[model samples]
Target: MNTFLNTLNSNNMQTKKPFKNLKIFASGFLMLTGLVATAQQTTGDVVKKADVDPGTTITDGAVRVIDNKGTIKYLQTQNGITMLSNTTANVTTTTWQLGGVLTDSTFIDIDGKLFGLNGLELIDAATESASTDATTESDAGTGTGYTILVRDEATGATKKLLATELIQSGQEAFTATLAQTTFALTGAPVLPSFSQVWVYRNGAKLIANVDYTVAASTVTLVENDYAVYAGDIVEIQYVK
Candidate 1:
C-alpha cells in the first residue's frame, strides 16, 4: 500500500500545472532575436551614403577608373575621355566629335579595327557616282547643284565634280591683244597642268610651242616670232 501511494504521488508531481510564462518567454526570445538581427548587419548590407566621391567608372579586369566631386575615385589607371556622337535617329552613319584632336596612333586605334572604316578610302572625291541614283547619298536629293570636290594637284585648285566622271578644269580663256604676246591667268586656277594649248589666230589654228611658249598661262611668243601681231584674232584654248 505504501508503494502504491508513492507511485500516485510521483504521478501527481509529473502532471503538475505547466507554466504559461514559459511559452511567452520563448516567444519573446524569438522576437528579441529578430530585433537584434534587424539592428545588426547580417548579410547583403548596403550603405546609403558613401565616404568618397566617385566620378565615372567602367569595370575593367579587376578595377576601373572613377571620379566624383565629393571624393577622389578609385583606380586611376588611365584618363577618362568624353566624346559626343550625333546622328539622325535612324541613320547608319554616326559623327563623333572629340573634345580635342587625337594623335595618329589614336586615329589608327579607332579607325583600323576589324569593324572600323576599313573599306572606305579617304574622302578625296565628294560627288556621287553617275551609276548611283541622284536620290542616293544625298543630303537634300537631286543634282541641280551637287558638285564633288577634287583637289587638282597640278593646278592646286579645288575642282567641283561636274558629272559622273569629269570635273570643271577652271575654264581659262584669253582674247587676242594686238602686239601683246603675254597674258595673265587668274590665281584661283593655279595654272600648271594643261595637256594641250590651242591657239586660234585670225580665225585659224596656230601650232603649239612652235608659235608660242606657255608656262603657267604666261604666254610668250617664240624668239623673233612676232607672227602674232597687234589686232590679230587670237583664241587660246586650254584642255587638261
Candidate 2:
C-alpha cells in the first residue's frame, strides 16, 4: 500500500502536469481498497456469547459477548459496568405476576355486546387453594410480598398501590363463616360512592345507615340487627 502511494507521489513530483497513467492509478486504488478491507477485518470488534465470571467487563467498541445461560439477554450497564443480562429479572417472581404479553393473544375487535359481559370478561378462578387458574386471585396485598407501584407525575415519587384492593364488577354473594364480623370482600378497597353498594341479609335488603359499612375488602355489619350471625348469608351488589 505504501509502495503504491509512493509511486503516485513520485509521478506527481516528476510532472508539472501532475500526470499519472490511468491504468497505474486504477491499479493502485484497487490495492488500497483491499488493504483497507484487511485492516477492518483485523481490528474490528466482535461479540460472543458464553459463560463468564460475574464482574467481567466488555469493552465499549469490541463485540460485546454475553454470558449465555440458555436464555436470551439484553445488553445493560449498571454502576458504569457493562453486562448482558435480563431487564425484567426480579429477586423473586410468582407464577401469577402481572406483566406484558409474551406471545400476543388473538385480538378481535369485537365490541362489548358479544357473549354476555358488556366489556368486562369473567375470569374463572379455582375454588381449591392449590389450583392456579384465572380466578385464583390473591387479595392479600400486604402479605403477598409483592406490590404494584405507581409513579406520581407531579411529585415524581413512586409508591405502592394499597394492598387488598377490591373493585366489585357485578353482583356477588358470600356466606359468612360462623362469628365472622368483617367479611373480607371478594373485591376490595370499597367502592367509591355509597350509592352503588347494596348489602342484603337472608331474604331482605339491609338498610345502609343502620346495617353495614363497606370498606376496602371488608363489609362490617353494625352487629345489632344487621350483625352477621352464624351461617348468615350476605349478598353484595356493586357496579364494576
Candidate 3:
C-alpha cells in the first residue's frame, strides 16, 4: 500500500511540473510583446511630423508638403513640379517665373487650337486644310464678308483682310499668233475691278489701260506704235 501511495504522489508532482513550465512560457511571451510595443512607441516619437513650412532649400528626393485649411499640397523635386490640379500661385519677381525664350519643342494648347513657340502653326497639313475649307467655302471673292489671313513674306507679320484685296490670278504666258490683236485667258477668271491688269510684252511689264484694255475674258492691246507680231511672247498677271 505504501508503494502505491509513493507512485501516485510522484505522478501528481510530474503533472504539477508541466503546469509550472506553461506559466514560465506565458510570462516570457508577455515580456517579448511588451518589448515590441515599447520599441514601436519610441519609433513614433522619433518620427518627424509634417509642418506648414520646412524652409526654402531642401535636398533632392526629400518630400515637402504644406497644409492649407486641412488640404495638403505636396511639392518635391530638384527642378519644377507638375501640378495636376489648377494652381492659384502668382508669379513673383523673387519667386519662380517663366523662361524668356521657348524652345521649338514647346507647345501650348488653347481651346481646340494648338500653337507652338512664337505663334508657330503646329497642326498637321491635313488638319490645316480641313480648317481652311471649313472657313472659306472654295471661293473668297469681294463682298463675301469673309476675311483672308495673309502673312507678310518679308516681315513675317500676319493680318486679316475683309475683302478679296490680295487675290490675284496666276501669271499666264503664251506666244502670240500672226497679228494677234485679241488674247483670251484660258482660266476664264472674273475681274471684279477694272484697270487692274498687268500685261507684259516680250517679258517687259506694260502699263494697264495704256498698253492694253481688259474687257471680260479678252485682252485687247491699244492701237499704239507697239503691236504684237507673230511669235511674240505675251505674259499677263492680274488680280481677279
Model 2 stretches with alpha carbons more than 4 Å out:
1-168, 187-190
The TM-score leader among the candidates is 3
Model 1 weakest lDDT span, ten residues long: 74-83
Q: List candidate 1 stretches off by more than 4 Å.
A: 1-168, 172-175, 186-190, 193-196, 223-226
- In candidate 2, what are the lDDT values of residues 94-149, reduced to their tens digit? 01112222222222223465633377534334432222222223444324333345
State the C-alpha lDDT per candidate: 0.42, 0.45, 0.49
* Residue 148 displacement in candidate 2 (angstroms): 26
Compared with the true structure, what per-residue lDDT tens digits does model 3 show for residues 32-95? 3342242233333333322212223222222222232434333222122211211233111012
TM-score of model number 2: 0.29
Candidate 3 weakest lDDT stretch, 10 residues: 85-94
TM-score list, all predictions: 0.33, 0.29, 0.34
TM-score of 3: 0.34
lDDT of 1 by residue, 1-240 (tens): 233224335555442221233245345535533422423344694333221122222222111112223332221111112222122232111111223322221211223446334575543346633433344344544555444567667855545554644533444456656567776666634343334666566666666767767786565555354555656656666655
